[model samples]
Target: MPDDPLPTHAGPFALGTFRAGRAPFPGLVTGARVRDLSDLVPSVRALVEDWDSRLPRLTALAARTDGTWHDLPDLDVLAPIEPGQILQSGANYRKHVVDLVAAEKESLHGATPEDARADAERMMDERIRSGVPYVFLGSPRAMCGPYDDIVLPALGEQHDWELELALVIGKAGRNIAEADAYDHVAAYTVCNDLTTRDRLYRPDLKAIGTDWFTAKNADTFLPTGPFLVPAAFVGDPGDLRITLRHNGIVRQDESTKDMIFDIPRLIAYVSTTTTLRPGDLLLTGSPAGNGAHWGVFLKPGDLIEAEITGLGQQRNTVRSSQA
Candidate 1:
């Protein structure tokens, strides 16, 4: 058992993983300095694999006043954890879904924008009643540093950003119930799910709606983790504020409360398909005001900042791909 208590300051303390150089190591960010937990837990993956047993030791290390404290700014924050698999929720936010539906209606059906939006809201309500969360597989290779540069693929002209709240699974469980889903969560992190908007659908195969593989899963596409705010620290996952800023302009500003299927539901639904294990990421979908809705898309040298309350923040710069 940890003799020391969890640290608290201006905000909730978070678990982070960083590499001063080549080797990745677990760290604890307690508002001021990042306490290196390498002596206790080597990597975030190691900690997650044995989270239940290692948490006390982690707490003990975090609580200690004496240790190798690195200035937070000096540390090179990694992706926090290299998840076993990434399970992303699609069209999970009600407002975002409605926005897409409304846009589709206006363009495809020639409905008035206002009427289209209203009708979409009605459709969303029906979905809430009869729908289950949409889940998709994401390549862990898409992961990159939170403050790293985003290399936009030239093939995909409409590069877009989706800021999401990513849940890190703690315990291994299959067929998890909605009520017990939270028990599987280890921590939370910010994930910018970059998409190639134009490549999202296969025009050749109109019947096949979305091509998630080509649209997503590019290297440096998923910007994750300035910190992994523990699930215990992030109270009421449904209430956190999610925001994204492109070139210093706020694009997506909404609450997690707008999610059509909350974390528990998403986890439960996904767990029904695959076992949720430690270090597995479950990305709750983005909020409204995506690049498509705004009639704007990412260009070279564009900067994106994404954040969720208590999860810390991520800053990504878009760069033209040489390939």
Candidate 2:
């Protein structure tokens, strides 16, 4: 057994779903011990849905050390919550987008790499000044356990990992204002949005931009949670550190401060199209450093370890599809 199965959060406790034998139930994790919350809530989603009322109760429960608790190694840890909807923010990281823009420009017939990068930086500044966040919808079916195996689909070879910070919505609201967006957030967790780079675009149809369905929605594509650290404990969502390691080597490392559009903007933007409800998730884009940056991709037997400050860690192994 590992010394610390669950990464340490800022708060004294966090919430997750776990199973010892028959059924998965909500658990309150503090240190190496997990107290089952099945009596209070059926699942973590249910706990999150009633976050406002249950938060104080959870805090009170966490204060006690005399509850019936289970060892972290004995239970099977599942994704913290099954979200009703997943809204993904794309290219919201300044350096990440600038790097992508520079690479693409260098590949095409254009100015020198330095010129391209300079232009990209200026573009990012302008975009931050006036543009809205680029958001997309993701399937809940893509979610898997934090320690689950990621099966590389047969359609692509360049499967990449993009570790991100995911926010769980606790309230129902549409057209939410940027000022009040954080009110909708219940908790935060770590998510690795694995993508098949080779199939990200349709070669036959250049007019149409991205093929997010084929590139992102593969089964076990999104590895989420070891625990859900409530927003109150998380402090500022804009300053967390996100780090990912591939086969024991660090691949992606950056701070949430790199985000061009913060959490509020992302939540407000997505809510304009769809209602932000309890148990919904919003992925606040990824920072610089990916497989595309290192020219490396995931393969069978490869191990990926992703973590965000105060959210928790994810340990996933990559495998090829049986098909």
Candidate 3:
């Protein structure tokens, strides 16, 4: 385990699921050490759902350096929390959408690259003014451990990586206001929303912009959580930096400040559509530098490393189903 000290505001603690020759159990991670919390809660999601009442006890336990703690490397880390619903935001980053439009200038009917970019920027500005977020449902079964290998299914060849910051909802609410959105967030975690570019659209149903189920929800596609850092530990959601490396080469590097619709707005907009419940995740979308932009897609045996400022890191290796 990396010896980097936990962030000061992190209260020297985070929550995750870990296995030690048995079924996974919720554990409290303090620095390079971990202590089982399974006695208190069955799973990390259960602890998060009752976070308001459990936080104080967990905090007290974190203060002690003595316990039946285990070295982080000795255990297998699993996806921290299993959310009841996964709400994903699409095209929420300004520069990411602009670059996507700019790169596909041929679709603009004789327009120059500059014209395509300008048009995309205008569209983003209009979107922000509309005061709504584009959110879609994600299948929870698609989630896997942050360190797990991404199995490249035989269905598509153009696999890609999209590192994002995911918000873990603690409080339940309906039609929530932007001002009160933060009150519902319990913690934040790192997530990589992997996609199969070739399956992004349906040939027969071109009227539908994207086929998310085919393109995204593949098994082991969504790599999430080395651990969950409490919201209090992360001061401002919009100020964090998101970075990803493909085969040890820096690819996606951008800040959350680039998001067109901020976190509060995303939560507020999502709540209006459906009730936001505890143990639910709201992914704030990926920034620029996806495979679509770099023109390099994931292949078997490739390695990906992703991280967000303050949050923990993820290191996943890619494998092909044929292997």
Q: What is the C-alpha lDDT of each candidate?
A: 0.85, 0.90, 0.88
Model 3 regions more than 4 Å off: 1-10, 65-67
Name the runs in model 2 displaced over 4 angstroms: 1-5, 65-67
Best by lDDT: 2
Clashes of each: 0, 0, 0
TM-score of each: 0.93, 0.96, 0.95
| Model 2: lowest-lDDT 10 consecutive positions | 1-10
Pairs with steric clashes in candidate 1: none
Model 3 vs. true fold: TM: 0.95
In terms of TM-score, which candidate is stronger, 1 or 2? 2
What tens digits encode model 1's per-residue C-alpha lDDT throughout 170-242?
Answer: 9999999989998899888899999998899999999978899999999999999877877777888889998
Q: TM-score of predicted model 1? A: 0.93
Clash total of candidate 1: 0
lDDT of 1 at 175: 94
